[model samples]
Target: MCGTEEEMREVAGRICRNYLHGAWKTVEPQALGFRRISRVARRSVLRSNSFTMDEPKKVLLRIYGQVHGERAMDAIVTESVIFTLLSERRLGPKLHGVFSGGRIEQYIPELSEPALSMKIAEKMAAIHSMDVPLSKEPTWLWKTMGKWTRTVREERLSENIHGKSVDFEKEVEWLKKFIATVESPVAFCHNDMQE
Candidate 1:
């Protein structure tokens, strides 16, 4: 139900009060010294006005939740992992403070377009240098291929589009053969670079 402006303001005030009253005790909000500048579709750009944080720091923050849950304990583990990795490589944001509260990261305001591109390219190169062994286990590959084939089959069965019959087994076989042709010593590849 919709409410008058005053009523809506009261509701918002109540919600904020509840939050301030330790309703979300486990996850305390901490200012990261940054603000979201703009959002276009699914992409968002965050700007930091302080001198300590940079684009890389924001990237680290963005991906933090991917490997970790939103809970406080999970945040601790994730932060530790991030710090360890960053320290090892000597290429991460400076850790300002840590606790049950959210992280306080240093902020950097401006970056030249060319410098940003170079920084991104360097990060990409570093990531691509990491070693990832190709799976030699045939059973796993067969299982994965089987699952994919089944999914495609189900989709085809549901759709009304009728034309030439698709030989799924042949397609799966071709895919398997194609995958086998890929040389080993695979490096981490991030196809999506737009932030």
Candidate 2:
């Protein structure tokens, strides 16, 4: 529904109103500065997947897709939960609001690459070690990759009618076997790590 930053903020304000209800007046609306901090790529096309809103308060807004579509929405739900938990534990950004396309989160200040990498490693280690209960079963790595693999196959076929077909079932079997061979506890991971 929202096509620009102003529109996005307006939608967020509406959501905040619904979330706060009678208490909405407690917080002041900030004159936010919007920037395309990052984007989530789909089929080689970049989408407004992530944006940073700065000023009185800074927050990272993640836009959600319409449906899971074999596992897409599943990933968002997973990330949202992870963000929520991270906020609660003070491990990641604070979660502000949630809407159709995405949710708002606290904006951590930028750091240099080396510093950022170190912090991320430390934070991820903490997340991995914590015994937190996720809302749903974490979709195993293999399943997530399989979804992308399937999408690639479909696109390949669609692009060229005579493209060599991929043996999806065989690929799935291989993925399962590969995943089975791994001997480590699976942790909730930010599969889409760029943002």
Candidate 3:
């Protein structure tokens, strides 16, 4: 997002300083994996994954990288709202700060216990039960897929989307029909949910 690793650090350091201040002036954040969530946004974990602050003792932090693509700014704003809600619910890390290019989020520590699966299911159920001020109809996915299909068609890359030939228009129709058959009640779902 920042074009290079050095630039990424420079940007992240500035954002971190704006929030955490003091110690950051001395401590350089170690790099973790830079993972891409979508074409629009990128996120990288600053491992110390355990940054120590005078007030919080030790904490974790993440920097949401520069966002691009059409309507990307709107997407970031929407995501920030939902993310803040989830943080308030204790389902996610607290959003420390949000800036133009990205935001700072509390880092979550690694969780690896045998009961993790059960705990995750409980959390997901809670998330599903919650009401969010958004559309109730489960149509956003279809609309997004439709947009992706159009983009693919424009690029003339329709043949490789499914690892084989596919008719974008027909596939969208098939998906609409198939999804309509399932009784998926509307709720606050994560973007990463699968059918």
Candidate 4:
């Protein structure tokens, strides 16, 4: 099933209440994709016969999509570890809580002005400089690409270049051969950098 807003709110509320401090008031869906984002706020109670309302301080609820149960667990664990490291280094958002499917993280505001290219490069350098406690084996890229290629072929999805069919399996084979020709160093990479 697609990730609905109601489902997102319910899950976010449950996560915030149990894992985070404060009385979580509401959860509003912000963005949705492979991962889901929601803004959660806390309730402020004021005394003295006054109908009081609190200013919303937002925190983000990030829910991971289900792929394969056991298979996905390792990836989640690795992500949690990496996020923790990055947050502590002030490179990524602060991690609030972790649940079965997802985690709560500090909400970062969108920048009104575009960052300088140098600043962006510095952040990327910092991320790459991190010595995360995960496997250094660079197998995930090829594995993921292979899996996607297989799925496409199995589903009989057509790809054409100039009205001629293209075989992804063969394409992958070609890439595998040509890829190693370029010397590339494996570093901690932000797989999802696009906003």
The whole-model lDDT of each prediction reads 0.43, 0.57, 0.63, 0.60
Highest lDDT model number: 3
Q: Which has the better lDDT: candidate 1, or candidate 2? A: 2
* Residue pairs clashing, model 2: 64-101, 68-73
RMSD of 4: 7.3
Tens-place lDDT digits, model 2, residues 64-87 = 545646667766767777778888
* Runs of candidate 2 exceeding 4 Å displacement: 4-6, 12-32, 39-56, 68-71, 111-113, 135-139, 145-168, 178-182
Candidate 1 vs. truth: CA RMSD? 9.3
Order of candidates by lDDT, top first? 3, 4, 2, 1
Using lDDT as the measure, name the better of candidate 2 and candidate 4: 4
Whole-model lDDT, model 3: 0.63
Segments in model 1 whose C-alpha atoms lie over 4 Å from true places: 1-88, 91-112, 132-148, 157-164, 167-169, 182-184, 190-194
Worst 10 residues of 1 by lDDT: 41-50
Candidates in order, TM-scores: namely 0.43, 0.62, 0.68, 0.67
- Candidate no. 2 TM-score: 0.62
Clashing pairs in 4: none
Candidate 3 per-residue C-alpha lDDT over 91-158 given as tens digits, one digit per residue, 9 for 90 to 100: 76667776676666665444445476567667778877888877787766777888898888899887
Model 4, residue 179: C-alpha shift (Å): 1.9
